[model samples]
Target: MRKNTIRPTDIKLHQKSRVLEVAFEDGSRFSLPCEYLRVYSPSAEVRGHGPGQEVLQVGKENVNITNIEPVGTYAVCLHFDDGHSTGIYSWDWLYHLGTDFDELWAQYLERLEKAGHKRKPAPAAG
Candidate 1:
């Protein structure tokens, strides 16, 4: 028998705060901002088909998740208020995003700065 991988035990969307809280079986929990998820979407529309083809997402500071649809037992499709719903976030990918949030977020900010895009401040949590 193979050892099982860490899987999300709970996922909650706080529309008011614009955050997705995910708790994994490994006792790790992440409160991921909607803006972060939108910019870091794994969809081909955002990630592109190959390396060095990533599209920089801007003006998404206030983007919020509109819906969460489960896909099979391993993934979910997040529908965003900005009409972006193509990204199918797998359990493994979501776990990776949670674990690597800090570095990935910094990289995204750096990319935005390099592109001369000034990101708006996130809305205050209510």
Candidate 2:
């Protein structure tokens, strides 16, 4: 389907925590975790200078969405707490993420493990 072909049926903002929930008419509900949104951001800060050069984002579990901007009728730009707002999430990309969520999330976790990175809640109190 085309970008404009599928319009978001519902949109909600979970303010104070910076989350934007978008639901399409196809019964596809995207609860997209906030951290996932930040890490997978399509901006230069995360996408890096070129392919395979993406800087792995860590310790963003508590990072929240600050703002969400609509890009025409095809995409949405996200603003994060770290001030890294540059990526525009196209509808097609968002759809893929919503559809293949499980697989993509697993891949992210695996990559983190391979990199010796841990998604710890926080360092144990002393």
Give the candidate number with the greatest TM-score: 1
* Residue pairs clashing, model 1: none
lDDT, residue 13, model 2: 68
- The lDDT of model 2 is 0.77
State, as a TM-score between 0 and 1, how close model 2 is to the true structure. Answer: 0.81
Worst lDDT window (10 residues) for model 1?
A: 1-10
Which structure among the candidates has the greatest lDDT?
1
User: All candidates' lDDT scores?
Assistant: 0.92, 0.77
Q: Residues 21-114, candidate 1, lDDT per residue (tens digit)? A: 9999989999999999999898999999999999999999999999999999988999999999999998888888899999999999999999
Q: What lDDT tens digits, residue by residue, belong to model 2 across residues 8-113?
A: 7776767554456779878777878777878887777887889899888887776777788899987888887778788898877677767777997887888888
How many collisions per candidate? 0, 2
